[model samples]
Target: MAQNILINDLPLEIFIKILKEVDGVSLGKCRRVCKKWRDGIDGSDQIWHEVCRKEFKHSSEIAKRKAGNICRWYHIYKNLKMWIDITTFDKKVREFYKFSLHDKSHALDVDYGVLPLKDAKGVVFYDMSNLKYIPVAISETNCCKVTNNDHVSVILTKTGLYVQKCVDSNGVTEGFFKAENFVLSGEVIYFHNGTRAGELLLYRLSSQKKGPMSRPIFDTLAILPEGKFAVQLDVCERKNGPLIIASTFFEIILVEYDFFPHEQEPKCSFPVNKLTMYKRLLRLKDRLQSS
Candidate 1:
């Protein structure tokens, strides 16, 4: 008969190798088995990275890019799991929040669990996790657009543009400019200059400092012909840099910006037909109705 071997008697390297084959839920249970197994599981970042890779698929790449060198694999896995639960309509997640808004209130944008709402009293950043609100001291009457990420919040109004650090409510950096539309991604801001037709500007915040003292300066990133106007703007973070998409009434333009050169030519443009435009409008209408 073969000799009976105990799990605790196994070497940590071999034990971790076995744990690698286990799913995240199973790994959590394994932690409860004993101190040795728990330490082995918790100490290895590779295991959590592999788990994230297996579960999140393509999203793992995006999350990794965002997290950078300070890789908190365990936290990343938990965050992704929470996102999955929220997106998949988990009953427990759904039942966590039950709040009503005013009839005139409008949701500006949502990032992570924070929802920025424009209502009778300026803007409020509502934390979905804790059910708390951080009221921003700004007038909503002229506020055209507002967006936030985990780090900062950017707001555009008729008179000017404003940026506030998410952690510090009093730390606001204000800039006076006329922008038709804008999108905030991380520390970068891409906006359409209303004064000049077909002109798009890129503003990058200084990483060394935060708050009112450090203001962002912009440079002209791209310019189209007089008739072509960018109506919609979006930015996606890539391994190298950012991929910007600007949509006009007739065409969609893609521009890639890297750190070294800071600017590059438009990668490509796709023309849009009337039917495609109509379909997009219809979808927007349906979304508004549902909301």
Candidate 2:
């Protein structure tokens, strides 16, 4: 009898060590090298779960850049598909389990703009394409909002804030207020995409609850933006007001009224498109503060 020789077969222990260095998918691919490697792949389910979370974050970041309803649908679905492919176990990833990409697109923006994001709890993924009073909680079949502590806010349709407590899935809402006047900008609630002056309320903040009992309040930070441009500028703390963040074809004027101290008079005006004057005011403030 001739002695049999085998090659390209690394010990499972050795391959497991190597697998630790590579990602779950790559590890899955590595398993194809031989039966021994394939066996190790089964033990790495935790890696696959981690990959799922990473994919979700990556998809959220990508979705934020797109604008408008049509653009959002195009971008979000496209990216979701890409993320699905990123998984080694694509078949196991159900479409129903994943969130939609275009929940808060060009649907409704009273005054300001918000980008976009899928709806999730404990983490606000608001679309910042436009501004609205109600932070919409939506699905393809139904839509609602979580307004107050009860987590069962309902729409009044007549158009205005309606406040009341309830025991239901709809969430509590601030009902007795005006909608057109109560325009929102990421202040009280952290929408993943809306702009409220200079404040970016995206993190999970531990809020101190106040009133009757010192209960920690969890009402999402609601930064109501005064619909006027100059008003919004007043809220921004930048010395020259808010920095005009612009892109190639688009323009934004950050009103500086918010950043300048109440007693100080503006030395120069900053037009919506030009910002050179704003730079001087900032430098002047720095000098004054330093001196």
Task: Name the top lDDT candidate.
Answer: 1
lDDT of 2 by residue, 80-164 (tens): 4433222222111111112333232212221112211223321122322211122333332211222221122222212333333
Which stretches in model 2 have alpha-carbon errors above 4 Å?
1-17, 23-26, 48-291
Q: What lDDT does each candidate get?
A: 0.51, 0.29
Which residue pairs collide in model 1, if any? none
Clashes within 3 Å, all models in order: 0, 38
Error of 2 at 64 (Å): 15
Q: How close is candidate 2 to the true structure, as a TM-score?
A: 0.21
TM values, all candidates: 0.39, 0.21
Q: Candidate 1, residue 99: CA error in Å?
A: 11
Per-residue lDDT of candidate 1, residues 204-265 (tens digit)? 44323566886666555666556765665544333233344455544445554343232222
- Reference-based lDDT, residue 17, model 2: 58
lDDT of 1 at 145: 65
